[model samples]
Target: MKKEEVPQDESCFSDTEMKEVIYAVDKDGKYDKALSSGWETKTIVLDKSLEHIEERKAQAIANIKNGIQSPIAYFMEEHRMDIPTLASYVGIWQWRVKRHLKAKPFQRLSAKTLQRYAEVFEISVSELKHPKF
Candidate 1:
């Protein structure tokens, strides 16, 4: 985008936070330097991303409450992980991780398997099985 379109607002960032942006410094467009400042456009994009995450969290909570899925799904979102990523972390296959996201399958999981998930989430098995929120 053009320099004119770049946002100069700092409302989304704190006084201590800053973003580095490279800009052309010469008419020949060969020189560049990093300017430390907040970009409103970046802030807007970050806000939208956070909003999307919140929406997903709400849906995960709803699914858990309705007994359509397990708390593992919620923890997955909380950790910003997809099935494959979580499976890799837990040293399991993606399909098995997906199965663990289901309420029935998760309920039948062995303690050893639950420990794997709990360790990845940095929580206890009890907390993993019954999340507070």
Candidate 2:
């Protein structure tokens, strides 16, 4: 692709100062770097990915409401984190974290453990325990 032909379509980064670096051919056919806001195909794929994430988040919230999962599950999806990542951040074992995703085990958690989760989610312990869905 030619430098001038580099895509500059508006995308998720359109409201930000970020740009995608793309390599293209300049006027003399020399390879050059071009900064693009984004491209259509990439934006479409990103939109789809975000939609999927949102769907998962909603499912988590639903599970919490139905008592099948704990608030930790909802917050995990909200923060776009997986069990292992949440466990590492909270300095807990992955298996323990997985168990806490269930309501019974989550209710049995100590204040210190809840505080750790609150800190990772950047919320108060109260908020972590009583998530607003």
Candidate 3:
């Protein structure tokens, strides 16, 4: 059955709107101390099951989508993220990080780096590509 017709009441995210929990640091003192000293992230949950959700889910499971382009890459196919950010989290150089995000590392990967990312994220290589890898 199609997602919209699946009879599911709703999902915990939005289909039309995109949101990010930006942990920004304003060292320039742009605002009140309370606002500037901490993180600020935007989170949204949608309940509507759309036709594209299934495809996105599949890509996520297959780990072939893309990079850590955005935080919402956690839930949607179109939301696939870029490589630099994922590299930052993975502690690898951006280019090197791009090499191992396929849920399966190719010939250029090291067992140690792959294992570290897997342990830190608590997901198999396959699932790593599903998120903002």
* Index of the highest-TM-score prediction: 2
User: Which tens-of-lDDT digit does each residue in 11-118 have in candidate 1?
Assistant: 554576666686744545455554546767777899898888888989999999999999999999998887889999999999988999989999999999999999
lDDT score for residue 54 of model 2: 94
TM-score versus the correct structure, for each prediction: 0.85, 0.92, 0.35
Candidate 2 deviant stretches above 4 angstroms: none
Model 3 lDDT per residue over 79-133, tens place: 3334565566667787655545443344345667656666555667655433443
Residue 74's lDDT within candidate 2 is 87
* Tens-place lDDT digits, model 2, residues 1-133: 9999999998989899999899999999999889999999998998998888899999998888889999999899888889999999999999999999998899999999999999999999999989886
Which candidate, 2 or 3, would have the higher lDDT against the true structure?
2
lDDT of each: 0.84, 0.92, 0.43
Backbone collision tally, model 3: 17
Number of the top-ranking candidate, with lDDT as the measure: 2
- Runs of candidate 3 with Cα error greater than 4 angstroms are 1-57, 60-82, 102-108, 123-133
C-alpha RMSD for every candidate: 2.5, 1.3, 15.0
Q: Candidate 3: RMSD over Cα atoms?
A: 15.0
Candidate 1 lDDT for residue 40:
75
Pairs that clash in candidate 2: none
